[model samples]
Target: MGSMEEPSPETNYTKPLGIRFIEYIKRSNISYKTHQVIVLIVTFIAYASYHAARKTTSVVKSTLDPASDEVSLNSLPWRRRPFSWILGDGWAPFDGSDGTVLLGEIDVAFLAVYAIGMYFSGHLGDRINLRIFLTIGMVGTGVFTSLFGIGYWGSIHSFYYYLAVQMLAGLFQSTGWPSVVAVVGNWFGKKKRGLIMGIWNAHTSVGNITGSLVASALLQYGWGWSFVVPGLMIATIGLVVFLFLPVTPESVGVSEEDESDSPKKSGAEVTSPLLISSRAEVKDQPVGFIEAWKIPGVAPFALCLFFSKLVAYTFLYWLPFYISHTAIDGQYLSDAAAGNLSTLFDVGGVLGGILAGHISDRLDARAITAASFMYCAIPALFFYRSYGSISLTANVILMFITGMFVNGPYALITTAVSADLGTHSSLRGNSRALATVTAIIDGTGSVGAAIGPLLTGYISAKSWSAVFTMLMGAALIAGLLLTRLVVAEVTAKIEESRSRRGSTSRSQPAVIDV
Candidate 1:
């Protein structure tokens, strides 16, 4: 259990019937271990579905707007298309001269709505039944996602139709992150949270890889199937989430510690946290957006994520398009091959998330670990850009390394850092701000995510070198944003070391001879 105690009246009243039935069947309350397992499994499925649906658009983007890239390829003359197979001639509206710009518009529109919605979603998530809130989001996301693909079947080509559908899906997508993170934060304590969330955060890259493979596999049938399949997946997982997710221990009448104690244990107060604040209070009222931002370490991390997500999402939305356009060893890959190959980037992201989390836990310095990974990404990006065209093997190796560096900081910040700040001691162990703080940090970052792909849409059209240069710059700025926090963590570590040395010398019995 977290520092949060006594289920809010809203949560208590809204407890799902599923948990009740399970407990009834068992003839006892579910144990803590059982709760943890359920939370991990359900949330993983839930968010993974969200990503799977989101990723469909990227895999299908080249198919929809291939002309712009084709023009550039012709201009280059060196890149060859020996292994490539043509999809369709590109869809209308997007197939026009302004196609790339239109695609960018819809992408930004979707993410813009998602970014704006994240703030309110976090605010509401704290006050309502997370299970229901998340379910509605999932269902809505599925509807809009399928609707976008339905354009292909329905012969709908109006730009506004696709824009509106994507924007709506983005709104629903916004709900997944805050709700899932809050649920996980509710169930687990801070002990080795990096390692735990690191393994857990693999859901992101996993979802991306799944979506890439599925979408690529389905392209031969039609691009519409790519979106439709992922749409259904998230909705199904959403049902699983509604049935099994426990928002908090109090909701299910489990012992606060989940240690087979009474429900009235009061969850043992949290006194070990290093920071404290005058702003902390005991009320169950949700934290205001402004109040949540006031928490220490929240602002810097949020700003850093702005740039970090900029880099990661740039790759997320454009990597496949980039791969298809850029020739490897005088050869181009087909849409399907490009889509499948992009999964390798996400495969590397999985390792990055785990490695970042594990490294942060060992060092006990989130900022240091995150900033270091970001700095490393600069070289990775440079190497990938310069050498990736030489051979397929070089492209794969550099892309994997680049993905690891770019996603490592992004994954750590979103999962562990957001969770840590939400429950920071500065809040006097108040868990109410968990969702709100998460919203602010991720919302700000989503703004950057929206911007990155949008800019890439234009910049890449002129010169991909310009786009890579832009990504490298964002990485540098992202790392620089953490300068203050990294310094503080380092200073604390040095002081702690000196204190331990002093304590050791004082405790020595041989001091009597001196």
Candidate 2:
């Protein structure tokens, strides 16, 4: 028998359908700048759909376990103790005396699994076709998200069923951040990453607002539609992603290395040997999980994000419920109104993310910028808690400010900071570590995201004030975690200023020269 020969370097192999489409686009003369724009828009929409699906559960929470007469009965002047408790009228399993605790457990179960899946997802993202990975995640997320809502139409109230669906949804949702960030990082360099990512990060707030509005509006039809609509929307968007997303520049035969050095933004250059060697090296020696964590600034940023996400996710999950239950002008709001009003918080978050990104870019200090935002969030939280209930105007104003401070660091860390660390000079231009680093940081933060809502569920039953206290404590610690990094940034700035001054003085003509 004749021995089989290995494929030659010049031999053409069967490419995936997505890659073939990308190659077709390349041959049709699309420019590099156009491809970059496509990358940004596709990723932005893709991740936004993920957030949109996640937001449905929070909006529908009120309908699931509504406030009972116990709340109104305790509101009377004659009552000794104001009994703010969940009564048995809610859906089974969640309506029992331990209903609130049970609800919190669902959040814990979903996030715990999400956190664990994140680690593995990141590892897999590095090795697989990101386009396929992301599409599977989005489609799976839609299926599971819809299943949770189907329970309503089916008249199913088993706690375990809903819990299982949510947990599975989280596992799929875990595929989003690492994949999107890694793809975006591959396209854009660090030149203006903070501002670019900041603007792009607005997708999160936009998705939340869209989800809240959609879900709240559909509540009149049925709470089931609230979840089902967003679920369908994401599934549809997933199809778009599968068709259009270019996972990396190379996937379409565009060399990012050549683009980086090219004077014009044309795609006429062939693949350079340096680019090929770099890719080969990365494929052979991908960064390990432990090694990614060991990158300078990774640990501090990861720890800071832990506390940052705790505060952010707590508000994401419970702010609507808190607003509905708390009296504004001695009147209670309907669940729909509360959900609609909650969009203001996300509106503020959009501005905060943009501002944080611009400031970090201008200052060239990611750590200091993020730490400052976390510090400011402390006062914002206190003010919102103290004065937010006075009037509708006050509530909107204070909640907006609170959201700005709270989400600024979160946006900065998850985007610009994560990208910066992922491509640290220490990596020596091997870009394989980007996904792994992103995963570890976000995965650690997901643990805090899990803890926050879980604690808020139990603490809110006792006192809302205690929940604020916990958030404030988390903010303070988040800022403190970045102290060393902030100092380093400050020192680097001072040295740079001195060096510029010395160069200016030397360059000036001497007045005493003949």
Candidate 3:
């Protein structure tokens, strides 16, 4: 019905049918606050759908290639049980001896493609109508995801077919994060960004929990249902998004009311729209990917996220399979039980993201908050590995705690921190770098995410303890990478406190003489 890219502030793009209808009904009564609410709701569900699709493979892993026995160190060899809850023989090709390796290959392939695609997606998102870009990505993702499930019905055992579908799905999935984050950044200011984005970022965990529950519940009917349902859900939501998603404040003729919206310096020739009270300049072009990365804090945060996302994504892709294979109090869980149980981790992640974001906002120091969370994760990982199998209750508690600590920094880095950097003061007044900056940081992290699962797939076969060790080490590295940034934040705070005290003493008019 329309072109892909929205026209600039100098020109008006035709509004979507849904938006045109909305404006006609509300007319001048519509307020900026109302638009903010709409933006949050739409973006939240949109990204959540993306995560729902991403989490399906994890839940379906044990079903695709059930093993004959438990690999836990505590279990007696004779006490072993079959891995699959429903599929006795498991799916062919994947059921072979090399099945585990094949699954790992699929994980790496999908993640690698996703990581590569992220860089390009960000660059493209800035220049296009974010709504259209996001819609095409979601629909394409749905198509590929459903195709993976359709293989089971078609009785297709070709490993290459599944691999191809997953790789394509990953590429489409890359379009989601940069698009949603940029949209949200465009609407809200940086004043309460930490708390707001932290709460908003829960979409990731919410999506995960939804995927796990839906995929797990549907597993008994068929493994194929897991992927197909989430696939359909995201595609449907994508259409809703296309109809209603306003890409910018100007899109809806509203103004941002925060200081961050004003330009600190000048760069772009155009001024913010009269309807939108922003500091932004209408740049003739979007920021280049490499130029966005050159912003002061971008590289370090990107590197830090590399390790942070590694630890988080490891649990995301493997926790269900790990739970199904390991015994809790000498009893192994069914595939469904494990899949359902894994939701607790994401439940905890929801808290962690909100907590981390709130803390960062309150402290006004993103680095310190993120680093602290990463450091705490080391102990949580150790405790979970050492004591989680003692009982189901213990496992749940430890898993939730581990998830909280592990995902806290990851959520922070990807959300509020990315937004802050994208709109860095150095950008002058240019507001076009949000998607690019988000892509650079997250794309780097996606590489680590891919490596973690691939490594876990192999390491778990030899010894699960070793996998925990790797995760702990990664968490440590993540925290350590932020050392310089954390130190700088601390130093700045100390100097500010001293300066405030000095000013107070001067204003007291000779307290010592009194």
Candidate 4:
């Protein structure tokens, strides 16, 4: 009571306005937990959209009745200049040789263009406005996805037209990962990111399941409808992201992690909606391409991702065909049944990813978790080769296990570890380079993605055993590469701690939130 009369002038002057606001939150128990949930949901939608668009091609091929498949290039009624000359100016062509070739090219053409576009799309996302870029990308992807279905409705038979659609569709698909990874990286920190991102990224597997279910349902009625469902779904989700998806947390007034500890409003602080343009504008130092590549652990990590993706994509493209055509002394699954069964792979993949994430989070060793799972997958791949001859049930079980192990590492290394390396403390606390860093890794991975399916197609055309051997080699190589990254990370942490303590035994610096 005596001291109240002399209320300290200095106490009022030094008290922070920001601290009071923070205290207000605690007193009311206000939390961003709701916002985090919304972010995850939207992110899931975006990833699902990507898979829906990607999986339509598989469905279309699956439902094709080999009995009804006829070559009609020459007999087509168009009577175009090329057709007239080839058919002796009056007689329609006798055989449909050109038709099959054109059809074959259409699918592979899409894959070729997709690999090329992935390399450059990340740069576009970083340089342009995210909302506009993502919106346009979604629209383009959806339109092209629908076009394939529309072609069937229109009775379109020109192979060239489908090739064009596939190429354009592939181009649009490139927009997904670069943009999604950039936004997600901005939302989270390196702390427990492996676990968090692992769970979050399971949308990849979920999308695969959703797409398979939708595709299988439609294939029984009309294969064309398969493409339309996914296309419309993507368009619908695009609208939601346009209306509600925040570019970054800062866009909503929450301070980014880098700024959470500092009260002063430094120009260097990253703000949100975590959009790439905003990131570029606010970062203290923008990393160059050369600098990003030169980072100690980045190259090895990128190589690991490349090889892992190679195996994953190979399975994605070829598994249904294998089950339908080569299963157990040619006792094959019907087209619809095969498509439905492969969905189980993604089901297992989702569980595997979540488990891997949680384990890595507790141990704080993404490399070890990734490597261990891949190594475990080797036996399952061998199991498929052995029991694949025994019974359909055994084959399905083995394939599901293979999917779980392979996809776990694929999701973890690409999302969680990429973010960690991208925002490593060596960057002078700038997290703005996430898009570029992720692009470099995934873009390099696209090379392997391009190679894997083509190699599998050719190898399976020869002997399925060769395909198994190739996948095994890829998994082993990926594990070795990640082992290198684990060593580098540990060494870097030791060096950093040493730098904080003086030669005379001073206290070590406190570890920052990852």
Candidate 1: Cα lDDT at 194: 83
Kindly provide the TM-score of model 4 when superposed on the true structure, using C-alpha atoms.
0.76
Local accuracy of candidate 4 as per-residue lDDT tens digits, 1-514: 2122221454323323332343345553122454466667777788788887777665444233221122111111111222222223111110143433454566567766776676567666666655556767787888889888786568676666777888999899878777777777777776767777877887786786677568656754455687887988887777766665555555444444333555344556554455756555556355667777776667877898788889887777666556666667457666446646666777777777877888888777788888888898788788888687588778778878988898888888778777777777778567666766777788777778778877776687678888999999999998888887678657866876787665436555666896
Ten contiguous residues with the weakest lDDT in model 2: 73-82
Colliding residue pairs in candidate 1: none
lDDT per residue, candidate 3, 383-467, as tens digits?
Answer: 9888999999999999999888888889889989998998898987688899999999999999998788777767887999999
RMSD of each: 5.5, 6.7, 5.9, 10.7
Off by over 4 Å in 1: 1-15, 62-92, 152-154, 213-225, 256-283, 327-336
Candidate 2 error regions (>4 Å): 1-27, 66-100, 152-157, 216-224, 255-279, 325-336, 511-514
Among all windows of 10 consecutive residues in model 1, the one with the lowest summed lDDT is 73-82
Comparing 2 with 3 on lDDT, the higher-scoring candidate is 3
Off by over 4 Å in 4: 1-31, 62-104, 215-224, 256-286, 325-335, 391-393, 489-514
lDDT of each: 0.83, 0.81, 0.83, 0.68
lDDT of 2 at 68: 26
- Looking at model 1, residue 226 earns an lDDT score of 80
RMSD of 1: 5.5
* lDDT tens readout by residue for model 1, 1-514: 4323444566456556676577667665567788788899899988988988988886677677765445331111112221136456778888888986787678778889999999999999988888999999998898899998889899888999999899999999999999999889888877778888989998887786687678767877777888898888888888878888888876765644557554335665655434333333353667788889888899999999999999988887678778888899999887557756877887888889899999998999999999999999999999999999999999999999998999999999999999999898877656787788888899999999988877887898799999999999999999999999999999999999999999999898774565
C-alpha lDDT (0 to 100) for residue 83 of candidate 4:
21
